[model samples]
Target chain A: MKAPVAVNGYGTIGKRVAEAIRQMPDLELKGIVKYTPDYSVLVAYRQGIPIYVPKGKEGVFEEVGVKPSGTVDELFGSVSLVVDASPGGKGAQNKRVYVERGLSALFEGGESPDVAEVSFSTLCNYRQALGKKYIRVVSCNTTALLRLICLLDRHIGVRKARAVIVRRASDPKEDKGIVNTVKLDPPSIPSHHAIDVKTVLPDLDIETVALIVPTTLMHVHVVHIQTKRSTSIDEVVETLSSTPRIVVLEGAKIGIDSTSKIVEFARDLGRKRYDIYENVVWRDMIKVNGDELTIVQAVHQEAIVIPENIDAIRAALRLAESAEETMRVTDKVLNVGLQR
Target chain B: MKAPVAVNGYGTIGKRVAEAIRQMPDLELKGIVKYTPDYSVLVAYRQGIPIYVPKGKEGVFEEVGVKPSGTVDELFGSVSLVVDASPGGKGAQNKRVYVERGLSALFEGGESPDVAEVSFSTLCNYRQALGKKYIRVVSCNTTALLRLICLLDRHIGVRKARAVIVRRASDPKEDKGIVNTVKLDPPSIPSHHAIDVKTVLPDLDIETVALIVPTTLMHVHVVHIQTKRSTSIDEVVETLSSTPRIVVLEGAKIGIDSTSKIVEFARDLGRKRYDIYENVVWRDMIKVNGDELTIVQAVHQEAIVIPENIDAIRAALRLAESAEETMRVTDKVLNVGLQR
Candidate 1:
């Protein structure tokens, strides 16, 4: 059985994911990728991991002399499964790039994660990625949607879902320049912009519209969902409250709550390491109306990626006996955060 | 026959609407309402039309100051109907305030024009306003939605509808002030949002979300509709293009044209007096995928409101053979810019 996985792109999410991967017994730190000199990359390098530097912004590591195998025979010739944990939207395309290089591993699909995705929050649909092709890990907001939607999907038959994404203009760290303007992107609605729900159900219909609002850190999604059959919002609340990975928040009864406080709560909650049976869920930003519900949810991107990636390597490469076995391993990793 | 209908809140749209309403044969000018005096008000006043103003905002009129009754009723009571020319969304709460005062006649729900209202936009279930208890005008975006949806309901049978609103932020001259984010409004989804549309269809299942962006003149709505019956998007476009009172422009193969350019074109097309009958139907915005179609549309808030107000007045007071006849009379009393 494979004991270690190499992670490329040691950016914001990559470092933590690298640590979490190292923690898995079925996994080892084969190597780490850093485009240039970064603090954590230097640490990992000193700790005896080979640090690969691929030159240029559009530098696909395969092009450089220190490459990731030229063909499928080459990838299988050296490494195990590759978890390319880079950044947002463009990264999905990057995953496609690696797959083109015979890295036919899957992450999570916003519409349907086809391959082995280490989906966080109850590991919803982790089984679907088993022994599959390419797996696409979703965006942070997409992860929040998976956690919330799976809860609703099982308790109530969720027929259709639509979400509006109000994203940050500048990153909390990326002080590239100064500008402020509310912009709407993909300008078109994405049919699968909803979730990494591929594992649980294929051929699902979830449409999403994303907008980039001027903010930073947490990305807020104003989500409204329609159920197949009508159910009271009271039932909706019960369904949400019962879900461990999801935090069902009640929004301010008067004015709209600021994005500032919502993200803070999610960051604090992520620290909890309770088992799936006893996780805390706060319903502060959840707005419900009959079978139709609207939610304002925020997720700290850094914390979500690591656990998901670890589980991905476990499930995709068949290191775990089954998805349940992978979960037990993921639960133990999550335990590290809870104890702190 | 009803005496002249005085136009209230004569600004960008109100000015043109007042001119249109004044041309009716059965309607005559009673007085005019102004917040801050401008060239338009002075011209209407010079023509012997008494202009009423709110107490403090009224220093411009030199004479015995006719205080604005502090409430809408002070003005609404004397007029046959009040055509609120305030900016879009600006009048929602205000409309609610006056509807609470109760109508002397129907506003539009096919209730009592003598007590309720009968707005323009022949497509809306204005007929329902005939015998209703209260009548309220919907937002301009909703107006465009109703217009486009009616075409779908007739040709394809609407199963579901979704609308995304991109709005202008500041009203440097016309629409002013930060009104705060949309808060605690039930039917947060437009199908359920207010205006009592159920008073008509009773089965209109619509979901709408609003976004505040940076713009001033026009609002754009991206609409996706799923039909019960399968009809090609070409058929849908053909139907929309054929629909009267719609401006369907032809250009571009990629996506619908931008919002600003759409409205400017409409303003130009709207210049033909007969455009009230032959509207520039928005054809460029339509896209078909299997049974689902998506469209990008822009509607001038100015055009939707003042005309509706004028029509509501004509029916509410039972002053004319029809609001159309009244509009013919009102057109002679005022003149504003119209696009060709």
Candidate 2:
């Protein structure tokens, strides 16, 4: 019998998580939680995925011409695991509900590391989250960094890393206007990313600064790493190419000159919502000067975390014995790194 | 008195060089040389610039319903200097003609450093090319690399450098099809660019690999440098911000997210041919780790060489007393770094 999973919150991350969970072979998606009646709720309904709302807000969906199946609190009794994809602080609040009902839960990146027993990156810390009551899949930016840094650290031993994240100001559905000026997050020397990555790699000497660009497509990261020993550019490229779910792009051969082109390529490939779950690393831009390595890559903010959440679910349920097994299953089912 | 300057081979670099020379206060635009009467030749004719052809090809222009002013050989006598913006290997062949006519010439980067007395980059080797009979302005990629390397070497003392040149397949007017696969130039360990930079900074140790992507807009460069001393990212950004022809783009502000947007921004700002002559450095993408610094910047393939040609013209004519004076005049007339 498949384990039942419920997605709480139907925002950017939640919608994707719900869809992914619905497709997984080992898990059955019970329903997705909605706070209000939005276009996404209709989307969930049209897809035949049940929708659950908060007790009082259930009628709001009816007023908007959509009928939610039941209340969000009722979902806990039927589901064995809850994936909390709510807003930042709300995930911590929902943890109380999950704990009371004796349910395992996975939290999205927006929640603090304190909300979970372990911060999980499938490639970095998949085994550690096994059987944990709560696991936090990292943010898109941190995931992009970890995907590359973990590979480097495993192969050549990364001593220190510094990165600048050129992030998209808002997702397509969000009404927030694109920033007109580059603003550094306060106490700007090192942004929240520095603190967040440490949750996965406790001893990583890393620092990050972020700028929100007006793009709704993806986030571009300029990463510089210092390895414990010298490595060549070819070695780095070879390692990255071998990694799962990391798409090393030859922009010239594939006609992907920019992030927009990459998005168009993804859409042309029939990706749902034009999502690229893999980190798009410019194959040509990877270079090593002595012991220092530099790479330029892009991360699809809405899609990258989806796979990690799936892997986290497997680990939390003790379904996969090892990280490789979990990653292989996730990649095979989701077509994670298959680029035409 | 204005120096008579003739531009040979009106292709991507040639046409821009001709127009830039036409607008300069110190130079007079003589007829431009044409091998065949193409659309560009018609463009020159419509702009009222004289068109000269090779001795045998003069009739070809007449056959195309375009009148040629004279033969290319005649241009040597009418003009004191020739900027040979012809195709690669053509510049070396034209050197014999310039030498035969006792006319000084500046060759484009396509030619070997041996083809000229000194390879010139206005920012790096302006003084070296003064009163030289033959000077070669390095290629667009070299010019872009030199611009930043020279700045870093001057401000913080660069020890060594490595770069990957993500090049465009062809200019917008060329018929070369975009590559369907990313291709590395043969013997990709160190491309010609590795040796090209040495033309300006003979003592600097640098290596580069190049990949041709399918795009006509611009070339993106990923650079990593090891400085002689440890320098903070803030200091590096400050030094670059103060540089004349390097435009530090706030990737967050003004919504310049990708190269296409930067091109669009240039068009909106009413840039001629949507050309961005300066290096578009992402302000937030610059970072420092230990003694190493990394930068991701885009170089406009056509326009970057234009300003350097203007500065080279002044140096060839013994017009500017210093690199500063020449750069100031070129920036003032061309509006080098101004972006909307």
Best by lDDT: 2
Candidate 2 residue B167 Cα shift, in angstroms, is: 6.4
lDDT of each: 0.53, 0.82
Counted clashes in each candidate structure: 86, 4
* All candidates: TM-score: 0.65, 0.74
Tally clashes: model 1.
86
Q: Which candidate is the best by DockQ?
A: 1
Q: What clash pairs does model 2 have?
A: A252-B213, A253-B180, A253-B181, A253-B182
What tens-digit string does per-residue lDDT give for candidate 2 at A1-340?
Answer: 8889999988889999888888888989999888878888888899999988888887789988778889887877899899999999899998888999999999988998999999989888888899998999999999888988998888889998877666666787777844322233421336688788999998998877665444577877767788999999788878887766788888666666567778889899899999889999877667687797777787889999999999999999998978898888788778899823
Native-to-model Cα distance after best TM-score fit, residue B296 in candidate 2, in Å: 5.5
User: TM-score of A-chain in each prediction?
Assistant: 0.71, 0.96
Full-model lDDT, candidate 2: 0.82
